[model samples]
Target: MIEGALGDLRNGVSRIAHNEKIEELQSEFSGDKPHLQHSKPLHLDPMFYEALDVLHYVEPTCLAAFLKLSQFMHRVEDVPNTKAYMESDRIIKWPPNRW
Candidate 1:
């Protein structure tokens, strides 16, 4: 899980850095502002999608680990059954909730 998190982090950072360079070049070569040149819906942005994908994977793992750790440390009386919850039919929306 940690490795998956790290991989996602690395991929997100790498994509952002590459896109930043692309934006810089676009701005230098165009009269319009970089943001204007890249005009698209927020949902269409690669970075935004990548972040959502990363959070989708990482959040559940972290939550499960934390719950297990809390149980091990006697911080909580009982850890909820994460496996069952994950297996259930559920639709979890992310940033809209975060926002």
Candidate 2:
């Protein structure tokens, strides 16, 4: 019975979180103005706290939310940036030399 109740609670919270993210994304991308110019600064403290909680508690909903948030924050690959690193004389040892 307790397990079922917890499952239901998790499902409900997940739905709410998913809906909120949808709303936020819609509002962020709907306007005619540039997203970066008008959008509010993102606060990352709560995200960090949620990540820590997920790490400690191992909750499914929190973990899913964290993963989704991480996906949203993902950046595209930069070829130029990688080129600079590749051209640099940085010696990288395979086993990393156990310290």
Candidate 3:
């Protein structure tokens, strides 16, 4: 029961995050209109906290995977050569060390 509730909460938060991204992109392309900017730090802090809240209810492996995926997505834009890595048809190599 608690696991289900936590899953729902996670899904709700994910939807909010997705909507915020969509709005930002629309604003960027539409030009000259103000768009709601989602606070990354604010959002992330709450998200991490919420994840922690339900950590006990969730499987350790699942939680670890979720966190890893979230971290990857958050750092996607800032990583060097991200576009090249994303667009490559062949296997792309990453630096031995990343930020």
Which numbered prediction scores highest in TM-score against the true structure? Answer: 1
Please identify model 2 stretches exceeding 4 Å from their true place.
20-99
Worst 10 residues of 1 by lDDT: 70-79
Query: Clashes in each model (backbone N, CA, C under 3 Å)?
Result: 0, 0, 0
User: Top model by lDDT, which number?
Assistant: 3
The order of the candidates by TM-score, greatest first, is 1, 3, 2
lDDT of every model, 2 decimals: 0.39, 0.40, 0.41
Regions of candidate 3 where Cα sits further than 4 Å from its true position: 1-39, 67-99
* TM-score, candidate number 1: 0.27
Q: Candidate 3, after superposition: displacement of residue 51 in Å?
A: 3.9
Compared with the true structure, what per-residue lDDT tens digits does model 2 show for residues 1-99? 868866765664465455646435533563433222233323442343333333334344443544434433331112345345546787342322121
Model 3: which residue pairs collide?
none
Off by over 4 Å in 1: 18-20, 25-42, 46-99
Cα lDDT of candidate 1 equals: 0.39
Better of 2 and 3 by TM-score: 3
**On a 0 to 100 scale, what is the lDDT of residue 13 in model 2?**
48
